[model samples]
Structure formats: C-alpha cells, structure tokens
Target: MLVDFSAPVAASPAEAEAAAVSAEQVGYDGFGAAETKHDVFTTLALVARATERITLQSGIAVAFARNPMTVAVLANDLQLISEGRFRLGLGSQVKPHIERRFAMPWSRPAARMEEFVAAIRAIWHAWATGERLLFRGEFYKHTLMTEFFDPGPNPHGNPPVELAAVGERMTAVAGRVADGLLVHPLTSVAYLTERILPTVREARGGGLDDFTLGLSAMV
Candidate 1:
C-alpha cells in the first residue's frame, strides 16, 4: 500500500532519514516525503541512503524550481542507492508562487510540465546509452554533456515520474504522460468516482495498469 512518511514541511535531513527508516521497518510499501519550506531533494537523497527496503518518494517536488536534467541525475543516483525504489513526484505550483516566492520563471505551466517530463526522459536515455543529449523543446533545450557533468550510466533504470494534479487539464495531462497521478487530500470520494477517474480513464483509454491513482485521507 502507498504511505506518506512525513508531511510537506521543513525538517532536518537527518530527521527525514530517520523517519524513512522507521517507516520501512514498520512494513510500509512506499514512504513519501513532501516539499515545503525545506529542501525536498536533499531529504529524499538522505532517505534513500538510510532505508533499505522502503520505496522513497517525493510527494510533489516543485517542478519550476529546477531544471529537469538536474532532477533526472539526482533521481538516477537515488534510485541506484535505494535499489530502484525511487519515485519522482512532480508538481507545478501556482504561477505567483514560482515567480514571487521562488524567483523562478512561470509561464504555461501545463506546457512547461509536458516539456519537462520529456526532457527528463531524454536525459535519462542519454545517460543510460552514453549518448550526447540533443533534446530540443519549446521550453527546454539540452545541447551538450561533458565528462564533468555527465552522470554516465545508471545502475538501475530511470525512476518512476509521478505527477500531482487537481485540475481537469493537469489531470488529463498526467494520465496521458505521467507514470502516476497523486490525488490531493482535498478531493472527495465522490470527485474521484465521478470526475477524476473518468477524466484519467478517458486520457489513458481505460487502461488501469498503465496508470496509478493515489489518494490521501485521514485514518
């Protein structure tokens, strides 16, 4: 079953690792860590190194904050360390949050996210095959990769890339492109049965195995 090891809040890296270890010991299938004021990627890396059996996941790392290539590199490393138990959950926060708070560019979030996923997969393919990155998209363009920057080959395959989406457009995109879609806590059961599920099914042609539906609730 899916599980969230911790909420999206600020915490020391050590604490996050400890939490992941404890969750693994408790027999959780997957442990998710969220993003907030703290550094989610660093925490995820630490957790991957600390836990042995548990699958480590970033509930929703803000996509606009970093380039997709960097995320791919880090995710590949984390997957290697965790024995291929890394889930890269991506989310594009509000435009205002990206531009005003994170000081990052925000335009056409859905389109940017589409390009971002493509770029990440391209980078992973390049690293896996030892080929030069020549990805060109409307938003992202990768030209070269030197020895110093190239991560070489990944021991494990590329990590699973999930997307957290709430709106209809984002949900449709997630179903079409993302490995999985994380359902937010605010969504009700009715919404899932009627709205979200139908939209995702339409996008994915009703193939249940090709998509994963994640939900959060009070236990």
Candidate 2:
C-alpha cells in the first residue's frame, strides 16, 4: 500500500450511476461505492438499474449501523436490481462511530459480524427453501419471517457476502463466513500475503480458488 495525501471527492448517486453507465459502456468489470455520506445501497441500486453488464458492490457498508435483516433485504434487492451482479460487502466500523455517530451498540466486533452474516444467510435460506427461520446467536436473533416479509427467493438468488476486515480475528471470521474478503487500503502486500492470506486459508481449510479478494489500491 502507498500513502495518498490528496483529497478525493465522492460522487453523488446520480453521478455514480452515470459513471456506472459509462463504465459499462467502456467495459469495466466492476464498480463499488462507499458508505460515507449517502447510503451505499441507494447509490448501488441506482447503478444497478443504470447498467447492464458491470458488477456492483457496496464497498463497505457499516454492518454495525444496521441489523442483519435490513442488510439482507438490501443486498437481496441489489442483486435483483443488478441481475446477479451485486456483491454485498459489510464492515464492522469502529466503536466510536457505532455508538456516538450511529447510536448503535458495538462490542466483540468479530464475533458479532460472524453472527450477523449467519443470521442473514439463515433468513435467505428460509426464503429460498421455505424453511422456518430459526437463527439465534449471541449478538443477534432472527426467528421470524412471515410470508409478507419474505421476498420469496430472489430470482437472481442472494448476492455474495464479502466482509471488510483488517484485524486477525475479523479476517478469520471473513474466511469462515464470507464469500470474499475486502482488504483495507492501509494493508501492505506483505501483510496481505502473509497474515491475511494465512489466517483466511487456515480458517477456510482449503484453497482460495472460489473465494474472492478485493484490495483497495491508493492512487
């Protein structure tokens, strides 16, 4: 990773959608948006509708800011909107931002994130297979999914969940639960190749052929 001191401007939802349209026209493979100001899902939904071929992802939506059910529904909708090109990227933001800014609880982030992902998949399973939604865990509990609430198995199926992590514990959780790992920009190549990859591989108990890895390069 390299240090970048320049200030970058974030694109508005309309601007991001236009960029996606242009990127798709120019044959870009994927587009991702952060969740700093506007909701990432809102921006991605717009991009999903405006493009046809390019993949879309929520670069790192604050999982601590919202519950698993809401995140699940948002990801599912984005997948539907993108026609199977939506990848759900989630992050457990720091404690201050979670408590002071978002007014959400923050504790044992790694364990919480693992449970969050599990709860989402449980909900998705109930919808996809018409089974009872029974997910109970330490950080979250989701045992109800009425017929009206269930979107009923998304046509594109649920999107792949990617967890954003820089710490050892969270990175291991990503390997155990997430379909991909979103590496932090500050992570060096050595750290990624050594610490991150090893932790993930050990937790996964196999190769990395199917798992996706996304790294943000500073320009």
Candidate 3:
C-alpha cells in the first residue's frame, strides 16, 4: 500500500515546500495539494521544486474552471519538472460552484467530464506523438495544436490522470478512462463493492487490476 500526504489548506509556498519535504523524509509515497485558497498547481510546483522522490498530485483540482489545454499544459510541465512524479487529479464540482464560485459554465457534468478527459488525453497524444488533434466533443473541441504551442514530449512521458467522482455516471467514466479513481470520503465499503465496483467493472468490461482506487475515510 502506498502512503500519501495532503498539504494543508491556505498554506504559504514555503509551508507547502516544507510539508512536501517532511512527507518525503517521513517516507510517504506521495504528497498532494487540494484546490482551496491557494492554487493547487502552484503549490505542487513549489513542492516539485522542493522534493525529488515523492509523487506530486493535485488531490482535487476543479476541472471545469479551466479548459483541457490549460490543464494538459500545466500537468505536462509539472510532470517534466518533477521528472515523472506528477499525477493530475481532476474533479467536477457541483453546478452552483462552477457557476457562482468559478464563474464558469456548467452543464451535464458527467458527459462534460467524459469529454474533458478525452480532450486532455487527445492534447497529450498530440504533444507526445505529433498526432493530429481532432477531438470534437459535444462540450469541447480541439482542432488546433501548432508546433509553436506544443510543449513537445516529456522525457518521462505523459502524466497519469486520476478523477474524483461520487455519482455513478462519473464513476463509470472514471473507470472507463482515468488511470485512477478518487473515492469520496463519505463513500462506504458496501457502496464501493455493491455500486462503484460493479459499475466500474461493467464500464471497463472486466476486472480492475490495473486501475488504482484512492479512498478517503473519516474516523
């Protein structure tokens, strides 16, 4: 089992760096930051510069707040900076937050999330393999990727995407596309086995041997 550490909320960059180093020194397998007051990517960038071995992750970054291209570029940059120690953890917050808090449009979260993930993957594929990006989804489209805008392939390759989901549709999407699933803290083992696992298995059309499940629980 891999142990992970979460950086505290509203922490300064120095504090984030110290937390990451401490987690690494204490032998944690990974360290992550959530999207709260401080930007998740900025905090992780500081941690990436501070530590060398421990994995860096945005524990839950609001996906709808930014477009796929922005996420792909930032994640790729962090992965390169961390020498492949980065994992992009994306979450689609509720509609109210998406509209009122982030001032971003929100609609059909499950379908939008599915398209969002596909778009990011397509962007990375174009960057990595020089493939033409023609991802045209109902919610997002990416038909342009000039070499001037491309960041090129990272020596470490593309970073893995982990999605956080509580609903069945989003969970199925996670199983279908994401490398990992971030389970909500309110989720129970019974629910995971009876609902989440079965749905995920059906979506993937088999066992989940290669997929990682990140569970959160409160005592």
Candidate 4:
C-alpha cells in the first residue's frame, strides 16, 4: 500500500520527508504524492531522490494541467532519475477545479481519460520503437516526432502507468488498459469486490494478469 503525504494540515517539507522515511523504515510498499494548488512532482521527485528502496508514486497528477507529451517526458525522466522506482499515476481532476481553477476545458471525463492514456502510451511507444509518432485522438493529435524532442527507448522499460479512478466506467477502463488501479477511498470493500472488481474482471474477460490493486483506505 501507499501513503498520501500531501495534506492541508501539513505544510512542512521536513514533515513530509520524515513521514516518507518513516514509512520506508516501517516497510510500506510505496508512498504517494498528490498534486494540488501546491507543487507535487518536484516535491515527490526530491523525496524520490532522498529515499532508497521504497517506490514513489504520484497519487494522481492532474492530466489537464499539462500536455500528455509533457507528462510522458517528465514521468520518463523522473523514472530514470529514480532508477525506475517511479510510478506515474494520472487522474482527470473534477470539472470545476480543472476548468475554473486551471482554466482548462473539460470534455467527457471517461473518454478524455481513455484518449489521454492512449496518447501517453503512444509517446512511450514512440520512445521505444524509435519510429515516428503518428497519433490522432478525439482530444489530442500528435503527427510528427523529431529527433530533438524524443527521449528514445527507455532502457529500464516504461515506468508503470497507474490510473486513479472511481466510477464503474473508469474502473473498467483501467482494467482494460491501466497497469494499476487506484481505487477510491469512499468505496466500501464489498462495493469494490462486488461492483468494481467485477467490472474490471468482466472487461478482462476473466481476471487481470498481474494487474495492480490499489485501495485508498481512510485512516
């Protein structure tokens, strides 16, 4: 499991660092950081650089805040910096927050998520294949790839892509494509097992193959 270190109640980097270190010392699988009005990636990258052994995850960095191309490059760079200990977790933040706060438009959340994931994969695929990128999606379109911009084949293999999701539609999407599932905390265990897992399982036509299960339990 992972611990969310970002909170309105805690403002100190030292506190977050201490919590991360302590979590590692106590044998936690990973520690997750969330992006808000405050910084998330830089802070978590620092934590990743500071710690050893324990995996560092993004709880769900807002996909709309930056382009999918940017996320692919940044996530790949951080994963490299952390020696492949980084997990890129993405989420489409709520409509109001995304549109009003960030001034980014909101499309169909599920459809946008699907396309965004596809775009990210395309970027990684371009990196791996050393081939020109030719991607066209409902939300994003990238037709060309240049030598200057492409990262070229990640030697460590692309870092795992974790999708933070809640609704049945989103869960089904994750099961069909995502490397991991970031479950909503508000869901009960029974709801997860019965409603959520079944959707995922049904999508996979049986069960997932080593697909990750991440539950957000309130402490």
Candidate 5:
C-alpha cells in the first residue's frame, strides 16, 4: 500500500512542494494532486521536481478535457522529468461536468474512456518502439507521426496509466486495459467484494497479479 498526499485548495505550489517533501520525509510512498482550482499536472510537476524518491501522480485528472495525444505527451514528459516515478491517473467526469465545465463532448463514457486509454498507450508504443502511429477507435484516431514530432524512448520506459472508476462498466474496462484502478472514496468493502472485484475478475480472466487497487478514504 502507498500513502499519498493531496494538496489542499488554498495551498500554493511552494506549499504543496513543502507538503510533499514532508510526506516523503515522514515515509509516504507517493504524492498526488486533484484537478480542482489548481491544475493536477502542474501540482504534480512541482512535487516531481521537489521530491526525488516519492512517486507522483494525478489523483483524478479529467480525461475529456484533453485529447489522447496531449495526454501522452504530458505523461511522457513527466515520466522523464520524474525519472519514471509518474503514474497517469485519469477519470471521466459526469455528463454535466464534461459538457458544461470542460465544454467537451459527452457520449458513452465507458467506451470513450476505454478508447482514450488505448489511444494513449498506442501513442506511447509508437514513441518507445518507433512504430507507425495507427490507432483508430470510435472516438479518436491517430495515424501520423513524424520523426520531428516523436520524443523517442525514455531511459525509464513508459509510465503506467491508472483509471478512476465507480460503475461496473468502467471498472470492467479498467480491469481489461488499465494498469491500476482508483476506487471511489465512498465505496464500501462489501461493494468492493461483491461488485468491483467480481466484475474485474471476469474482465481480467481471474488474474490480478499486476493490477493495483488504490482507494482514498475520509477519516
């Protein structure tokens, strides 16, 4: 289990960096940032620069707000900057937030999120292996990658992608594709055993040796 620190709303970047440093000194395994008034990536970037050993993650960055290409670039850059200590945690916000807050399209969320993850992985694969960029999904398509644009492979390899899910469909998608699952804080143990675990097991063919389960709980 990894302990992570989330920066509060009123906290500045400097304060957040200090908190992350303190968390690391106190034996926390990771530091995370939520996409609230302050951007998640920016906060984590600060933490990444300030802390050398602790892992950095975006607790729940909105996926629809940015395209897969943009996400791949940011994650790759952060992975390099953090020396492979970054995990990209993404979430599909509810319809109102997607349409109104992000001013982005709202459709089949689970399907779109699955494609989003796939597209990002495909982009990373293209960069790491020098493969042709040819990922075509229902919601996204990418088939162009020039040497001028490619970042090439990093010394630490590609960053892992974690998906935040509450519903069974999304959970199944995460089980099928994501490296990890970020459980909603409101979830109960009973719900986890009865609904989430079973769905993920079915999706994963009864194997979860490499899958990480992350939960955030209130005191």
Candidate 6:
C-alpha cells in the first residue's frame, strides 16, 4: 500500500518540517499539510526545502479564502521548490468561514470551485504559452496579464490540483476539473461506493484512467 503522512494541523512550520523529514526517512510515499492553524503553502514550502523525495501536498488550502492568481503563483512556486513533487490540494470551506472569516462571496460553491480551478489553469497557461489571460466566469474574471507581472512558464510545469469533496455536487465538480479527489477521513466505505464513486464515475464519463482518488483513513 502506498502510504502518506499527514502532518498534524496543530503543528507549527518547524514541527511539520521535522515531521516531514522523518516521514521521508521512514519511506513515506507522500506528506500532506493542512491549512488549519498556519498557511498550508508556507508549511509545505518549509517541508519541501527540507525533503527531497516524498511528494508534498496541501492537505487542503482554502480556495475561497484566496483568489486564483495568488493560488496559482503559490502552487507554481511550491512545485518548483519541491522539484515537481508538489500537488495543490484545494477546498471550498463552509459558508460561515467563506463569508464571515474570509469576507469572500459564497454562492454556488460547486460552480465557484470549478471556475476557480479553471481560472488557475488559465493563468498558468498564460504564463506557460504567453496566452492571453481571458477567463471570465460567473464568479471570477481575469482578462489582463502583462509581462511585467508574469513569471513565465515554470521549469517543473504546473502542479496537479486535487479537490476535497463531501457532497455529490462538489464531487462532480472535482471529477470535472481536478486531477484528483481528496476523500475525507470520515467517509465510509458504503458512502464512497454508493455515493462518491457513482458521482465521480458519471462525471468522469465512466473512466478514471488519469484520475487519482485519495482516501484518508484513520488506520
């Protein structure tokens, strides 16, 4: 079994980095950092600088708390820092956090997340191929990208994006737009087979060739 270590959400950056180092030494296939107490990207960046092999992921970075351009930049930089070993894990937090804590708009979360991922991809494409940044969606708009602000194509290419899902609508969105799906630790086998898999299968057109399904179990 391919095992991954999830850094404690309560751990500080230093603690997480040390844990990640130990995880790598012990032959963990991957390490995931959460976005609870500290910035997930920041913690992962430290972990990335310290480790060489184990894949790094933001167990979840709140997608609604930040814009797509910022997220694209962060993920791109992390991919470079980790030498192509980075995976961007994004999630749309609950409405209270989105609206009150983050002071961001909250409506049609599934649709918004799909557009968010699309916007990030559009920005990366613009940087990679000098394409115009013209992604105008119902929730986000980005029609400008000047050379002065562009970082250009990354050497490691863009990192793969994974989305966390509980509901079928969000799961469908994840299947449609994300490279993978992050299954919650609370997900039951029955629920996965009956609800999640069916939704993803239908959304993915009955194929999961290039898709990754990550389940967090409390083994």
lDDT of each: 0.83, 0.87, 0.90, 0.79, 0.90, 0.94
TM-score of each: 0.93, 0.94, 0.96, 0.91, 0.96, 0.98
Expressed as tens digits, the lDDT of each residue in 1-219 for candidate 2 is: 211111123778887778778777766678888888788899988888888887888888999999999998899888888899998989998999999999999999999999999999998999999999999999898988888898898888889999999999999999999999999989898999999999999989967867989887675
Give the TM-score (vs. native) of candidate 3: 0.96
Q: What number of clashing residue pairs does each candidate have, in the order they appear?
A: 0, 0, 0, 0, 0, 0
**Which stretches of model 1 miss by more than 4 angstroms?**
1-4
Clashing pairs in 4: none
Least accurate stretch of 10 residues (summed lDDT) in model 1? Answer: 1-10
**Selected candidate, larger TM-score, 2 vs 4:** 2
In candidate 1, residue 33 scores what lDDT? Answer: 78
Please, what are the lDDT tens digits per residue for candidate 1 over residues 18-62?
877887888778778778867777888888887778788888788
Error of 5 at 190 (Å): 0.9
- By TM-score, the best candidate is 6
Question: Which should have the higher lDDT, number 1 or number 6?
Answer: 6
- Assess candidate 2 and give its TM-score to the true structure: 0.94
Best by lDDT: 6
TM-score, structure 4 vs. true: 0.91
For candidate 3, write residues 1-219 as lDDT tens digits.
Answer: 787888776777678889999999989999978888888898888899889899998889899999999999999999988999999999998998999998999999999999999999999999889989899989999999998898888899998999998989999999999999998878888999999989889888978988888886442
Candidate 6: C-alpha lDDT: 0.94
Off by over 4 Å in 5: none
Candidate 6's C-alpha runs over 4 A off are none
lDDT of 5 by residue, 184-203 (tens): 98999999999999999999
TM-score of 6: 0.98
Deviation in angstroms for 11 in model 2? 1.7
Candidate numbers, best lDDT first, in rank order: 6, 3, 5, 2, 1, 4
Q: What's the CA error at residue 150 for candidate 4, in Å? A: 1.6
